[model samples]
Target: MRNVLEAKNINKYFKKPVLFHVLKDISFEIKRGEFASIMGKSGSGKSTLLYILSTMDTDYKGDLYLNEEHVTGKPSVELSQLRNKHIGFVFQFHYLLLEFSVLENVMLPAKKLAQLSHEEIEHNAMQKLKMLHIDHLAKKRANRISGGEKQRVAIARALINNPSILMGDEPTGNLDSYNAKNVFDIFKQLKEEAGLSLLVVTHDEDFASKTDRIIQMEDGHIIHR
Candidate 1:
């Protein structure tokens, strides 16, 4: 299979009062359709590495490739476009617009991308919702759903754009044990049915172990992969 993402000798530093290295020459490749998790304790720089991979933090020193295309140091405008087209993100908090209906929230990104008409956007959004088994709640306000349901809605929204890679930071961090497993099952289902590559940062051992590979980081370096 082809590689979906590659990082080469990535290094990051932060300076508030003094220079501090946060990432130490991190490198890895994630194949297309593979599900992987990055695990590390607090201050291990896993989240910082994630931010770099997501193209949200470009201050690092290294090269990043997505589908063999070099994306490191790209302008923010171009990165923004790339993110909308190829990268989908899920967070611990659903971050859904409480005032908007489920369907609207899912359709929002695709609408901004404008690759499809209103009719097509709605159709695609509904299909994603159904795939997540939340179509019945499409008309409900985002705030009306339970925590598990809201997380599912967030996943549907993330998939609405058909991103090649899905990145999650503490995706299950906010859910209870049962709901965390539920989210993991949904992630697995999505990978099986949609062939999407996943990179998730999670502390739950059960959830991380279920992924195809585990990348463990410590003190700004990958200790295991």
Candidate 2:
């Protein structure tokens, strides 16, 4: 498979009264259509690493390449465009707008990109929701859905823009065991069906073990793969 994302000698530091290095010389590469998981204990910089890779936090030292384009140090506007066009993110909590229905929430990203007309957006949103088996909840308010359903809606929203890569930060953290398993299964199915690269940070070893590759982090560094 071709490389979709690559990071070399990545380092992240947090400074307040004192400086704390959260990631130390991290290097990794993810290929197209690959499913990989980052496993770590709390405070191990798992989410921090994902944020850096997702371009949500760029105050770090390293080289990052997405689809073979150098992404480090890009202007905020350019970075936002890149993220909007090529990347999708799923967080532990479903960050859907409580005021909108499932369909509207799924259409949010495409709306921001302004690349689709009203009909196109609605059609695409429904398609994604259907793909995730959540189309039946299209008219339900985001806040009214169950946790698993909410996560599914978030997944649908993430995929509505057809991003080439999906970054997940403990997506199943708030789910029960059954729901977590279902979410993982959905992720696997989406990775196969969409042909998109997946990089997930998961505390659940069982879930991580199901992925194609497992990256273990400790002391803010990748210790195993």
Candidate 3:
């Protein structure tokens, strides 16, 4: 199978405040339909690596490919388009607009994408919510839902674009164990059932252990995979 994401010889430096190296000689690939996690302690640079992989941090030195297309050095506008089309993101916080309805929040990404008609976007958003079992909360205000429900809404929003890869940064860091497991199971189902690729940075050992592969990091370097 083709790789969904690949990084070759990635190196990053924080030029300010003493010019420190934050990531060193990192290289990895996440294949289509695979589920993986990055695990490390604070200051380990796992989240930094994830940001690069997500195409949001373009200051690093290396080659990055998404779905076999070389993306390194692409113009920011082009990268934004590519990211919107192929990458889904779920962060530690839901970051939902509190006043919007859940359906509107879920539809926001697709609206920004603007590749589909209004009817189609709404239909797709509802489909995603239904898939996540959060359709019942669609008309409710985003802030009115429980934390777990809010996260589920976020997942639905991420999937609305049918992205080639889903990326998460400490996605469960703010959730309880039950909600964390729920998120994990949702990710697993998305992999097994929908054939989606996922790369998540997490500190939870149990969460890391359950994924198909764990890329362990230490002091800006990948120590294991």
Report the lDDT of model 1 for residue 187.
Answer: 88
Alpha-carbon lDDT of model 3: 0.96
Output the better candidate (1/2) by lDDT: 1
Residue 130 in model 3: shift from native, Å? 0.5
TM-score of structure candidate 2 = 0.98
Model 2 root-mean-square deviation = 0.9
Top candidate (lDDT): 3
Where in model 1 is the C-alpha error above 4 Å?
Answer: none
Which candidate tops TM-score?
3
Q: Please give the clash total of every predicted structure, in order.
A: 0, 0, 0
Error of 2 at 225 (Å): 2.2
In candidate 3, stretches whose alpha carbon ends up further than 4 angstroms from where it belongs are none
How big is the positional error of residue 80 in model 1, measured in Å on the Cα after superposition? 0.5
Q: lDDT tens string, model 3, 145-214?
A: 9999999999999999999999999999999999999999999999999999999999999998999999
| lDDT of prediction 1 | 0.93
